[model samples]
Target chain A: MTSELAAGVSGARMIELGRGECLALLAGVPLGRVGFTRQALPVIRPVNHLVDGDTVVIRTHPGSALARHTTVDEVVVYEADDLDARTRTGWSVMVTGRASLVTAPWEAARYRALLIPWTDRDVDEIVSIQADLVTGYRLLR
Target chain B: MTSELAAGVSGARMIELGRGECLALLAGVPLGRVGFTRQALPVIRPVNHLVDGDTVVIRTHPGSALARHTTVDEVVVYEADDLDARTRTGWSVMVTGRASLVTAPWEAARYRALLIPWTDRDVDEIVSIQADLVTGYRLLR
Candidate 1:
């Protein structure tokens, strides 16, 4: 197939993923950025995450801005990417979801076991996003 | 001071930085992620960047996906982050700007002298983004 035809087919496939597939891709990646609002201004930060069923789980401290913004039902945007420079082939998935602080002991413990940050930072709050809209796209070389 | 008070003050400071302070932060960082759409799907990859006045400059191969997506007048998002795991302190800056392929011979040579990727990757296309909206925040311990 021509490059144009291939791109058309890929575009159709991307539209089909809509939200669920995007969530899956986001779950597979360990690193992503969470875009939220801090006092009406946009704040974006890198987060280490895990996919627990349909929710995206992130760990932070109680005093962290990430913890404060992610209350119980606030809307936020999350993005994750997997790319290869060699072939210039990769995909990025974005999830616009409702964030909630996971206060349940058991749920928090489970997340604590799975999602580990690459730093020795304090993690007192566990935030999870129940995605409302998930979208993704794959770039073919 | 109590942790609560510190957190409150830090949150306010972070919000201020998120509004306009990102321009300087963007200039200081050497590496960042360039986000673009390929086949209508969002893709992001790590790249070495240079600050040329109010624009972010990065180079790629002639036939790279980034080169294709970053046509003249195309809007793209460029993000850079500096994180310190010891204190759990970090900052991220993002630039949503218009991208164009750099063709000026002397300008391209100047960029070649400053921005060099740490990998043996092929780079033939030089792209620059004139920042339209810049936002960022720093996390306090």
Candidate 2:
């Protein structure tokens, strides 16, 4: 099937990861990069995230650009990986979804308490990305 | 100056990185994520790269999507970071540039020898992104 491609490298092979495995690996990692279009160009930022089922959530300060700009329905890309540079063997997951600030008081408050942002800034905004598409790959030896 | 911003996080502060420091940091890292638009949506991929002056170079197989789509003058974003997950302290660099396949026989030959793909697949295409804009930040404790 054209579903994936495998290529060998120094006894290691690249494999396409399934959705279930991708979500599990994402939950295990605390940080990832978020990509969005701004000024008609792509922008990426490193942020810590939490996986709620298939949705990804992140906390940010109100003063942050990500918080100010992502008000409602912003299509974005979330990526995280645990690859070792020296070994070049690991897995990376990419999630494409629409990001919106969590406006519901209950959900926002719960995330604020559950997810400690990588930055120590006082975070007042929680952005939830509903995954529309998920793709991942792993390098195995 | 609007050139930079600083925010405190615990005992650390987030500071904007200068261009010189950004380039130096990128030169030290071998891998990064490249972002480009596909079908009006943003896509991110983790690929190993080399910093040549203000340009970033990557090798991809001709069969790969990146090589097929990025024929010439495509705007793309390249991001790389070195941060600790536990401490969340590190520097991240984001570069905006026009990516084009290296067509010159001499240049392609040189890069083909210098930059090795992380995957062991046969790679025949060399893409060079000329950095038109460079931005970076560091979380320091």
The digit string of per-residue lDDT tens for model 2 on B11-103 reads: 247899998899899989888999988877788888888999979998778866677667747788999999887777898999998888888
* Share of native C-alpha contacts between chains A and B (below 8 angstroms) recovered by candidate 2: 0.41
Query: What is each predicted model's overall lDDT from 0 to 1?
Result: 0.67, 0.81
Model 2 chain B TM at: 0.87
Candidate 1: clashing pairs of residues: A19-A134
What are the per-residue Cα lDDT tens digits for candidate 2 across A1-141?
010132233524789998999999999998899988877878888888899987999977776666756775878899999888777799999999888899999888778766765554566688988888999989887
The TM-score of candidate 2's chain A against the true chain A comes to 0.85
Clashing pairs in 2: none
* Interface RMSD of each candidate, angstroms, one decimal: 10.7, 7.4
Fnat per candidate, as a fraction, reads 0.02, 0.41
Q: lDDT of candidate 1 vs native?
A: 0.67
